[model samples]
Structure formats: C-alpha cells, structure tokens
Target: MRIAVFTTCLADALYPAVARATVTLLERLGHQAVVPADQTCCGQMHLNTGYWARGLPVVRHHVETFEAALDSCDAVVAPSGSCVGSVRHQHAMVAARYDDDALAERATAVAGRTYELSELLVDVLGVTDVGAWFGHPVTYYPTCHSLRMLRVGDKPVRLLRAVQDIDLIELPGADSCCGFGGTFALKNEATSSAMLTDKVAAVTSTGAQVCSAGDSSCLMHIGGGLSRLRTGIGTLHLAQILASTREHPCPVPEPRRPARRRPSLPGAAR
Candidate 1:
C-alpha cells in the first residue's frame, strides 16, 4: 500500500528520529511511504488557541498539500493523535467559517483518509510487531487526545507487547493527560505544570527506563519535568519504539538542559 507520513511539527523539530523510525517501520512492512517535504503543521495550535482567523490559511495549506497525496495514497498516516484529530475534527470548522464549502468538502475527504500511527498499524496494516527488538523495558503513556478523543487504546500496547526483549510495564494511570495541551501549558501555566508533575511521578514510579507515547508534545512536557528533577527517566515516542530492531537500535535522546527546578506536586512549582 502507498502511504504519506505527516511528521507533526514537534516531531520534526524535537524528535526527527521518530519520523525516521516511522519511515523505517512502514518500509519494513513492504509498503511505500512518502515523506512530503511540503507538509507543515496541521494548524492545530492556532485553532485550539482560538486564533481562528490566523489558522485559516494554515488549514487551507494543509488541506491542499495533503489533498494531492491523498488522491493516490492508501492513507495519510501521522505519529500524532492530536494532529489527526485536528484534521478530522477542526478543519471543517475553519473552512465553514469562511464559507469555503469546496475546501470544507476537501478537508473532510482528506480527514477521512488520515490515520494515527497506531490506527494504521492495527486497523489498516493489520500487524503488531514489524519484527522490532528493544532490550530495555518501556512504559507507555497514552496521550490524552489518542486515548480520549481519538479512542486509540491498546493498539500501542499491543504492538509493544509483541516486541522482542521489550519488558513493557503498565504505567500507573496510563490514560491520564500529560498536561501538554498545546497553548494550555502556557495559558494555565500553573495547572499545566501541576498535571505534568503527576505524570512524571507516575512514569518514575514505574521504574521503567523509558516513557513513550504517541504525542511528542506531551512527551516534551513530561520529559521536561523528569529532566528537571534529574529523575533519570527517559522519554520516547511510540514510533521510535516500534521502529527499533536489533540492527537499528533507537537511542535515548541526550537531554538538552537540566530541568530548571523540581516539581513539588501536580501543578506546583518547587
């Protein structure tokens, strides 16, 4: 099958290896995966922040960019549930506001074709393992959108269970939010930090070497807290784990900076 990979903005800038792993997994399955360089942010941040007017053109650009590829590809797959949710749920609202019926229709059509990574792997591709092998134990955090909004449950866990030498641990409160709701982190700074504190605690409590999820944004928030505390808990995306094999091991990223300070509690700064 032919597929187009939409590496979300955070994945592109902060977790490029996640994108590389996505491509690796797709090719390992013997499918054609194209990385469209013209692909940009899905305008989710602007739309979610209520900057509707600013998000219009960005939405249009995405619809146009993916429309061409969707016409010929089997599916448009992304590593982010939030981005997939934006394309599925928000694009039409932006189009309808401007009375761009054609664009709205196009947006809907493309949204229907878009799939989150887990969705594509389990539902469309119909395989769990892709023959990956990771020696370390991994604990997965189901990002809020993928777990609640997208309802992508267990697909990731199922894949993880199938990997060789991957001691998968059930994260305590694995379904809880990681507190990185785009602008929510900035707008309600206190609340966001509070939620991240709990998330990091849960991840550390697992004693798992790595904490992974479908969304890079949430991982960044969770990872930032873990790093600040010098907790030694590493963060990775789901794609990176699925892309790992004995020959091609996924390395834990080097921390960019020490956490500014320790988190005292959920939403509390120490």
Candidate 2:
C-alpha cells in the first residue's frame, strides 16, 4: 500500500523521530510511506480551543492537501490519534459552522480515508506482529483522544503484545487523561498539575523503565513531569517502540531538560 504520512505539528517540530519511526515501520513492512510536503497541523489546537472561525482555513487546507495526494497515495496515516480524531471528527464541523457545505462534504471524504497508525497497521494492512523485538518491561498509557474519540481500544495494545521479547505491563489507570488537553493544561495549570502528579505516580508504580503512548502531546506532558521529578523513567511514542527490532534496538531517549526560569530583574531583589 502507498501510504501518505500526515506528520502532525508536534511530531514534526518536537518529536521528528516519531514521524520517522512511523515511516520506517511502514517501509519495513514492505509498504511505501509518502509524506506530503503540504501537510500541516490538522487544525486540532484551534478547534480544541474553540477558535472555529480561525481554524476554518486550516481545516480546508488539510482537506485540499490530502485530496491532492489521493492520486499518489492509497490512504492517509498519522501517528497521532489526537490529530486523526480531529480530522475525522472536527473538520466537518468547522466547515459546517462556516456554512461551507461543499467543503464539509470534502472534509468528510478525506476524514473517512485517514487512519491512526495502529488502525492502519491492524485494520488496513492486516498485520499485528511487525517483526519487532524489545526486551524491556514497558507500560502503555492510552491517550484520551485515542480511547474515547477514536475508539481505538486494544488495537495499540494488541500490536504491542505481538512484539517478540516485549514485556508489556498493564498501566494503572491507563485510560485516565495525562492532563494535556492541549490548551486545557495552560488554562488550568493547577488542576493539570494535580492530574499529572497522579499520572506520574501511577507510571512510577508500574516499575517500567519507559511509558509509551499514542499521542505525543500527552507524552510530553507526562514525560515533562516525570523528568522534573527525576523518576528515571522515559516516555516514548508507540511508533518508536514498534519500529524497534533485534537488529536495531530503539535507544532510550535522553533525559529532557527542565523548563528554564525567567531571569530576575537586575539589582531588583539582591
């Protein structure tokens, strides 16, 4: 299958390795992965923040970009369940709110053809085991969008379980949100921090060296908090784990630097 890779904004900017892993995994499975240069954010941040008017153009751009790639690609795939959920669920709503029925129909068509990485691997490619091997105990956290919005239950877990030498442990409160609902974390830092505190605790309790999730945003939130506490646990995207093999094992990610503090005004406090 000729797959068009929709490298979401977060993956493109912050976690390019995740997108690279997705492409590598697809190619390793003997499928061609084509990344459209025109692809951008799936208008998720804007829509999630209730900026419908501002998000319309972004939504339309995504539809047009993918629609243009249809001739060269068999289907569209993204590593992010959140972005896929936005494409499948929110794009048409943006169009409808703008009274663009024509665009709405087009967006719906594009959305129908897009698939999250696991969904494409299991549902479209019809393969569970991608010939991967990782000899380490790892736990998975199901992101909110992948669990509730996309309803991609067990697909990711099923794929992970199929890996040879993988000790997949159950994550306590696996379905709980990692407190990174895009802008929600920024808007409600106290609540978000409290939620993240619980999440980090649960992750530490699993005694797994690494925590994996489908969405990079959630991982960033969870991973950042873990890094601050120096829990010695790392967060990785599912694509990175799936892309690993006995021949080429996935390297443990380097520890992230804590957020820098703003400089104090000169001669103000001292």
Query: Relative to the true structure, how large is the alpha-carbon lDDT of every model?
Result: 0.89, 0.93
Residue-pair clashes, model 1: 3
Top of the candidates by lDDT: 2
Score candidate 2 by lDDT.
0.93
lDDT string, candidate 1, 1-270, tens digits: 999999988888878888888999999999999988798999998999899899999999999889989778889999999999999999998999999999999999999889999999999999987798888978998888897778988899999999999989999988777788989999899999888888888988998889888988888888889888888778889989888889988886665444566557887754
* Candidate 2 structure quality by residue, lDDT tens digits, 116-186: 99999999999999999888889999999999999999999999999988889999988887888999999
Q: What is the C-alpha RMSD of each candidate to the true structure, in Å?
A: 5.9, 5.7
Note the residue pairs that clash in candidate 1: 194-266, 194-267, 228-259
TM per prediction = 0.92, 0.94
Off by over 4 Å in 2: 256-270
Any runs in candidate 1 off by more than 4 Å, and if so which?
254-270
Model 2 poorest 10 in a row by lDDT: 252-261
- Per-residue lDDT of 223 in model 1: 85
Clashes of each: 3, 0
lDDT for 159 in candidate 1 is 93
Q: Residue 84 error for model 2, in Å?
A: 0.5
Q: Which number leads on TM-score?
A: 2
Worst 10 residues of 1 by lDDT: 254-263
